[model samples]
Target chain A: METNDKINQMNDDELNKIHSDSLGLNVPENYFFESKNRILNKVVTKEEPKTIPFYRKKTIWFAAATLTLFLGLTVCNKYAALDEQKIADQLTDSIAQIDNENGATAVSKNNFNNQIPNISLTAENDILVSSLFVEEKEVDQYITNCILEDM
Target chain B: MANESDFIDQLISETHRDNAFKKLLDLYQVRLYWHIRKLVITHENADDVLQNTFIRVYKSLANFSQQSSLYTWMYKIAYNESIRFLEQNKNKHSISIEDVNTKYLNCLLEDTFFEGDAMQLKLQTAVSELNYKQRQIFNMKYYDDLKFREIATILEMKEGTIKTLYYNAVKFIENNIEILPVKKGESVQNTENI
Candidate 1:
């Protein structure tokens, strides 16, 4: 029985025949091949920058312009700040000069008012000499005190 | 070293002089797609991953080493890329063993991308029973017809380990098929054929 079974065993040709007996299945004729070819061609095709969307191109240009403007403004702001500081300094000097003139005029008027009795009683010649000498001395003393206080 | 230099020269010259890259795309795209499809188990995801793989290959062609065959290196890249895609999408769906096996089987049955021969179907069934690494080794070796050494380079495994995996996978398929029940005349005919 084992010898008969051994004789009955099929060979490679018989197996090939069995496989061949089945229906031959070909790839369906459909859109897949054409679509795949289209995809492949699209992938391999060289695309230029112009082919990109307008919005994206515009965004790139906008970004570049914005950066350039920002840098230019930053440089301009630095120079502008320096010029503003110079103008501010000149205005501050003018204000200091006005303050000095007002202070001196107030001191002189106070001295003149305090010598009222001598100005009313005396004739013009006598009052003028005394007033002039006293005022000169007072003004000298006032100027010395003002200089010391300032220092 | 000389062989490596020669291969690099060939690749560089091919890049410069000919459209050999289109031939490469035709040869590798389907195989790589199927390999990635098995891992990802979704046609759309597989398609995207396959395109990304080719794009990366095109970008990094200048830095490619010639120590291995171009296919081996490409397979390695594709395998890693598939794993990375899986990792990135791991949160989208929780993958289970049963889910993986069922999806893999269904993809093989439904995918129009491959040549659906009877032997290919049988091979797919055989592969479905294997563990993940075993399935990978079997597919690379049997379906892709890659050498064990090339597979080792692709999978970064020892050659001996890949050999053992292939052997075990084949044995498992054969044993599983042998134990299936049969009718009397059918059994007699099947035994006779064997």
Candidate 2:
């Protein structure tokens, strides 16, 4: 009765015809046969968040670039900074040997001071200065020499 | 249909639930497919929304509560799911509603499942032009043949408001739908009281 009352609103035959034969969308053959599993599959997998492809995700691309730069910095720090003290000590020892071979102490020390303007370690014989490692002013001088060499 | 409360009871039960759900799908899927088809305007889209609707219905079984008829509750889900699909598609493709409607019409024309003639196409076009809420009112009232009270319940609108919206939608369709044909003696113009 409600359906009839609603249909009665279109009184004219042309209007009625249009209303009666609204849309003629064809249903596909066997369409229903496969849809059950298809829908069930989606429901089963719905709990897992659908992953946006890495290439498509802007965040993923940004993260990959950030990780690469971070790793490069880490490798540079490990290889470069850890070896600095050993390299500095070995260079000091080699220079002392060269000075001793020349049979000159004060003259060799003066020449060494001139060569490395940044390194300032006081010594009567250069050996005492070379043997030192982290007595405030000496460590500062070592750091300055390393920085100058790096620059 | 009167035994629907029993059906719901069985659906909520663990033992009879799976069989009852399969039965529910078999009964409602075809009806829902056509209902969604009229709104979404494509076989592929309707098929997708139908699946989604059933999936939602299955998940939301605990909430059924028999507040409305089973089909009506399911119908509400189908309605919401279809609209959500349309909105998502519109945003995903970066198209205006007008552009989206045009694309749907084009799809309707090309789809193998669309066997409508010119007038049918014109009716669909007119429906597409109505305000979205008005289209919802119109489809529920006209095609689905649902009562104003039921539609009001589904849409959560007042009955009077739904009546006004439906009338307004009918008038809108009347104005927008061309290809109004008449018999040999009848006049081209229509005269009537609202």
Candidate 3:
């Protein structure tokens, strides 16, 4: 074991000597320039514009077009709904005006009738009795017609 | 309010500046490259890892809190890059380290790179004999002259463990050196076996 240790030490010394001796093996003068050129070539190759895969480009275009179509449809629908609401509002306003005019005419006619109380009550009673008679007669006629039709 | 501390703080804050990056590269490139080279065992692999290490340092400079020494952080990056490179290349080679050594030996014998350099040949043999971790520890400690503390930080290991690995590696190299033939016409020295 001791001998082995000594031999190992000797080997280390010898290796160290070789290492020192081999130091500064003169690199050829153009070595660095050549290496630089090689590196530059590699860099250029890496930086060159790469053609995108067809599927990837197609997917990007498809996504963009789909997005634009969706946004356009959403905006168009929103405007269409707004226009529909405007037309509905105009119709509702016309109906409300008609109802107001009818209510006013009915109140005015009631006020005019109040100015002629005597005739108003008699006329109203006559109208009521006539409407009741007409209704009853119509019912009797309907029943007679029904009986005749059956016969 | 020491001047030196202020200067170091200013320097760290300016690490994003081109001059500061150049300074850092000059200071650390060789050391980091050698550290990486030892693990990957190829110059090209080391260069790639070294470049990646610097690029990472550049990208992460803004996040560098001077909590640890710059050397420690840089080494950690280099070490990780080296390991990653090794793992990436391991599958491509389709050979284990033992097989790699045999191939390397065959290449060395035929190649002119180490012609007439018996010491270099012997050194290669000795290094090849080490296991992966031992080679890493040995190279970092001996070749890079890194302290056990620095190695521990880089490797994310305890200093005591690094020390043990270094000792074990040295022992392995020493025992294996004798088995290797010295040079042409040299008799083998009979050394006491471990």
Candidate 4:
């Protein structure tokens, strides 16, 4: 009997009967049961019929985009407010320093107003009006007058 | 047991799907586990593949339209899952399929779940030496006790091809297994003729 012939003779039944003893492997107890639960958990997670794909939910993405834009605009507005406040603080401090230096002479409000013409204090851009109108020669003359008045 | 179509319907039916699938698991889990274990060659690997197989079966149950028997479809899935698992490992490690199969068989020796004696180890080595597809075909035919026609359906190959491979696989095993003797009339064929 050739090898092939002999093998053909040992068909499914004979082969199984002979090899079952050797190959009958074992697994941990309750492995299948616990593993089934695990599989079921995965199945439940996968089979959500009501849930839509992330890309398809355009409204949610749009809402997110709008919210992000709104937050960005608000942050920019806050920065602008802080910058304007910084300008106002610097302007107020400068004005206080000048007032302190000239406190002794006590320049009249109308005279000081006339000297620094159109000294507008506005909240829009927190600008100071010191050099808006005064020419260099006129500013030198005003400084001399103030110094003379102080003396 | 329900008839084939009834069983498939039960497996697909939402009301009866769980119960039917549980029965399917109970009926086929041990056999399928062992079948996958033989191909994959470790209890742990077998467990993973077997779970994947059943989950696939459950998911594809609705799409099953009785084109083939449920057994054939499930077996096909089990075989595919095992192949997928091995292919994944092979690709991840950049190894040939033969090298992966050898590694799996070598794993059997040190695997705690494997309680095979020396002869059993020899059997495993002999079976492992067969070509990969033949090894699976042989195991399906021999251990799983599946008919060649059913094996063909599961493997999605020609029944004749499965039969030829199985016989050749058996011959190869007979030659390799040390304890399996070439009896009085059985002679080893020449390499050229074989």
Candidate 5:
């Protein structure tokens, strides 16, 4: 081992003079320039933003259209409900006008009575009842005539 | 042009990355080409390995941990790529690694780009005789002129180990430097055994 070390040390001294600066390896002219250009081309290809064609954006457009359609349907349903409400309000107003002009029929009077609970009439409630145009005796005679006709 | 840290920042940043990488290629391409040439021993192979090395460097810049210098890191990648190329060629030809080296070396004289004389050929043969690690350590030290510390970092070996391997490789070359009058053809096996 000592002899080997001595030989190695000697070789080191000798080899120090003999540099490996050139091993007679030569490249083709412009090899580095060509290689760098090739590598840069590859890198540039990778770095460029990938563009999706308009046809390929189908899912995004599809989702947007569906959402718009859903919103439109929801708004239409809401307005339709409001129109129904407005028609109801108009019908109620018309009925109130008719009652104001022609007074209460027996059916409407009975419906109003059915809606109210039985209670001792206060003086104010008696006045409200007396203000109605319908007479109770006439309503009873009309009812008696309808029963006779049916018989 | 900036300090290495600033340069690394530019390399990892999106806006400045492409220009920084081009600068990197300009700075290291020739140096790396020669380094790889000494190992794989052909202009074509060196060109391939160098390009691959730079491409890897660009892709892996974001992951560059600053523990080692960028120079050391790039050398490590080039070394690995060269080894990988040699291994792939060996597998493709169904030959041993030594045979692969021999195959390339035999073709050296015929290669249009190889201008090596008999002495250089002798030296290359002596180098090829060294084991894989010793050959790598010796080449980096002798040709690339990297310090023992730098070689240790590149090869991930202890400095003392690299020194020892380099010395041994040199000794082997010195002992084996019988001047080859001509390139060995079929007799390469006999000469290597000697």
Candidate 6:
């Protein structure tokens, strides 16, 4: 009962019986044949080059569309931000120019009052106010002439 | 050897590969099926693993370095595929491999294809009782008659280790199983040593 004496001394004949008997493991009739065919069918199918039509690939189309939309939105957003910044900078320059013109008019009136203390003050003030409507080219020339005279 | 080399070349060649693969399936499918069947313990699982083994062999034919015999290479693939199938089932059921084997043993008891007698069933139970590696070595040695060196090569274990594990497994089965004498008139239908 300690050890199976048969296995210890089992001869080749007994071993062959084990090999030939298939260990009571049976398959359905013609199972191997059918299984071979099935395996072959699968292998052949796999071996054949798989060719999917480009038009039939929906995921690729979807990915491409998504990328295009993302890029389009990003480009539009960048340009929109740039345009807004440009308009703000233009408005800032315009306000700076208007301030400079007002400053020049005040400075010119002060200088004229100091130089012509005895002249009629009402008429001179009217002329100085009228000069405020001068074109930008004429004002630039006047500012340059004032700077040169001061130098 | 020359013939096998030629065959291997054909298996890797595009024009002749399909035909050569068909020949390979004819030669190895039954043997591989039985090997897988013993591991999985059910015809359906064996069938699935066998098909997968052949498919793997087909796909990997080009990488065959001819370092080992074609039989050995294919046997290795079949062995790995059976293990993979078992692992997948183990994971799917959220159970250990031992639990999966027990579940399969229960299935085998109810399987129509399993016609083992009481002695055969006892031997199977004893074999199942061994650890997984020991079980594999025992089956491949006892049932398939694979040499220790070949088993070592397939399992990537040292030959001495394979021998030790195999003898230990044999001892375990021998100690567990009871040997009944054959009746004078009855034929020896059960496996030897059972």
Q: Candidate 2 on B1-194: residue-level lDDT in tens?
A: 44778888878887777667766766666667766876787888898899989999988998887878888899989989988888898899897666776576787788876777788888778877777778778777665657888889888899899988888887777788764333334432331121
Identify the candidate with maximal lDDT.
Answer: 6
Q: For candidate 5, write residues B37-151 as lDDT tens digits.
A: 7677767777788888988998998999989889889999998999898888888988877776666577666667777677887777788778878888877876665788989
lDDT by candidate, in order shown: 0.59, 0.71, 0.60, 0.70, 0.72, 0.74
Q: What lDDT tens digits, residue by residue, belong to model 4 across residues A21-50?
A: 656455676766787677666653344468
Candidate 6 residue-wise lDDT, B1-194, digit = tens:
33789889888998888887877775566667777888888888889999999989988988999888898889999999988988898788788878876675687887778887777778778877888889899888766667888899899999899888887887787689764223233323332222
Worst 10 residues of 2 chain A by lDDT: A117-126
Clashing pairs in 6: none
Model 4, B1-194: lDDT tens per residue? Answer: 33667777777788787777766765666667777878787778888898888888888888886787777777888888988998898899898878977685678776667777777778788877887788888778656668888988887799889878877877787778755433224443421132
Query: What does the lDDT come to for candidate 2?
Result: 0.71
Ranking of predictions according to lDDT: 6, 5, 2, 4, 3, 1
Segments in model 1 whose C-alpha atoms lie over 4 Å from true places: A1-151, B1-18, B37-45, B96-102, B106-123, B178-194
Q: How displaced is residue B155 in candidate 1, in Å?
A: 0.6
Better of 1 and 4 by TM-score: 4
**Which residue ranges in model 6 land beyond 4 Å of their true spot?**
A1-22, A45-151, B179-194
Candidate with better DockQ, 2 vs 6: 6
For candidate 1, give the lDDT of residue A5.
27
Looking at model 6 chain B, report the run of 10 residues with the lowest lDDT sum.
B185-194
Residue-wise lDDT of candidate 1 within A11-119, one digit each (tens)?
Answer: 2223223322321112234422453464466455464575666667888889998888667755655676566656655555665566576764443333433433332
TM-scores for all candidates? Answer: 0.51, 0.56, 0.51, 0.59, 0.61, 0.61
lDDT of 1 by residue, B1-194 (tens): 22435544544574431254554564466557656766665566677787778767766667886678777788888888887787666546686544655567675556554444665466556667788788778667544557888888888899899888887776776675543223233542343232
Please tell me what DockQ candidate 2 reaches: 0.20
Q: After superposition, how far is residue A15 of candidate 6 from its true place, in Å?
A: 12
Relative to the unseen true structure, what is the Cα RMSD of model 2?
A: 14.2
Better of 3 and 4 by lDDT: 4
The per-residue C-alpha lDDT of model 5 at residue A34 equals 85
Per-residue alpha-carbon lDDT of model 5 for A53-151, expressed as tens digits? Answer: 887898989998888966775575567656665765565566666777788653454455455443332444445544444698977898999999999
- Which should have the higher TM-score, number 2 or number 6? 6
Deviation (Å) of B166 in candidate 2: 0.8
DockQ of each: 0.03, 0.20, 0.03, 0.13, 0.22, 0.22
